[model samples]
Target: MASSVTILFLLLSIISMGGALASSKPSGSSDPLIGEVCSTQSHLVCTNYDDVQATSIAADQVATAASMRDASIQTINDLQEDFFLESSLVEGRKIAIHNNLNDPAPSRPFVPSSAVSSLPELTTYNALDIMSYFGVARDSSMATAIVTAAYLCGGAALPGEAKSCAASTKALAAFVASELGNNVSIYATKGAPTTYSTSTSHVKAPVTILKVAKGSVEEGRKIVVCHHLAFPSALYYCHAVTGTKVIQATLKTEGRLRAAYIKAMAVCHLNTELWLSRHPAFKALNIARGDEACHFLVENDLVFTRALQTSG
Candidate 1:
């Protein structure tokens, strides 16, 4: 029984040792089929995993580029609006030039009227002079600010579209001019009513009397046109577009005061439109045609032929 037990123990020990040796051998070296399968599996896993990682990285790069493109487009639109607003002021000045050239009030010298003891001479209160005094440049920083706001609001557009804006502003200015004429005429022809006092500040400017024609003045129309001589200067007229009011110690003709108020309001509204129109992004996102955006304010009064007739 002792010999049988010892032999069994030796046989078991040999089998355990052999199994341990087989387990310790390198996998690739043990059998060609096993090695090939393991190698192929490892290669497949590496290739598949690496491809996925590459695809994810490429996608991230493409997304980043697209985001940058959108931001750049927005920036360009903002700039176009800025240009439009600043240019509008220039257009206003041009309109004034047209009106002034057609009118003869600036060329004539005047003597105070003896018949109307309460009033100054017609030449002294010329409308052209008043306009000259109030005309402001459109190239100012304030003008630029107005345009920028307009651009953001989608009110302004490229040069092609600027014509309409110019036309609208010019028409409004003409309307204001007509209104000023009436107000000045009333003050000149009908001495201030008992309700009003003619303080120095309220004293009528001589320039306000300049009329379109002799008949036009007597009929109660103060025909005056003004243009800004300075290319980039602001007139600080009776109005500013930003809702800031300027007080004046002099040149306080009722017409001028009223005109200032009107100008201030107009500037605020129009400036916003001008900048928005000229924005680069505005053009890119243009829902409307370019020509429709910018309109020219041609001064019908400024035509040489019209001036000749009116001056006579």
Candidate 2:
């Protein structure tokens, strides 16, 4: 199993950016989707986003760096074992993220994914070479998505972590069954985070806990945050850490004219020790590396929570 970070390097602007199996009932086709998914983006505001930082927030889910999508990559990870260059990877991510936030964006504007699924990868990416890893054409709309998926697949799993990349809902169902079980419900949101006036300065997509989901809630329940990966095709990276919480809520963001309603989810990873101190999320959330961190599941990110058992 490959760690999410292993894929982050590849997933971040082509270098940037889950699960299981068996004895499992698949989440039916009619299975309610967490929220909504958009293949193309109208805007992208996220910058150097990843779970590595405490304040990682998605301005838009599907938006990403244009360079990541169009760049041709090399197979550096395959040939070089000593990849995961912390400095280089971080720099590349910053550069790509800046590109994403700047004007004259990609043909398809995207709201950058503040999908704080996991920390950035240790290695860096060169692009395209690994596209072969996911078995997709370079010219395909899903080219960037496929390569990112491949990076996740090829990542090396770390201790106390179970990881995978599901290309379809069925695949995601299988991964969930293996990791969690049928006794769970999914949650998500497609709305913007509630805005507030800050004393110092206005932050980008701050994490706001509007309310709790209408359902049975419990403490210490196992949870999996299935972040909608940036794939042209439907691909999801469902992630669960040792200490995580999933809260489903009916949230209404402070719209410009009127309030808009949405079913939103907030995922909090209690274990922040795994991330690097320099990750931007930490600063965004106003916390240190060792402190607990929380972020909204933006861009159609889903949260699978253990459901209360009922007698038939």
lDDT of 1 at 130: 19
* Tens digits of per-residue lDDT for model 2, 1-312: 742210001111100000101111223322123212211121112233222222322232223322444233232111111111112222112211111111111112121243323223212252243333334455566655444554555565433466665544434555665667644555444433234331211233212223443223344456665655544334555655567654444433332465443344455555668765654556655667767665544434556655555689
lDDT of 1: 0.20
TM-score of each: 0.14, 0.50
lDDT by residue (1-312, candidate 1, tens digit) is 322110001111101111111222233333321121112333201111111110111122322222322132332222112112222333113222112111111111111122112221112122122122223223333223222222222323232221111111223223333333211210011111122231211222222211111111122212222211111111101111121111111111233343211111001112224344545534533533232122111111110001111243
Give me the candidate number with maximum TM-score.
2
Q: Clash number for every model? A: 34, 37
Runs in model 2 lying further than 4 Å from the true structure: 1-142, 190-216
lDDT of 1 at 199: 20
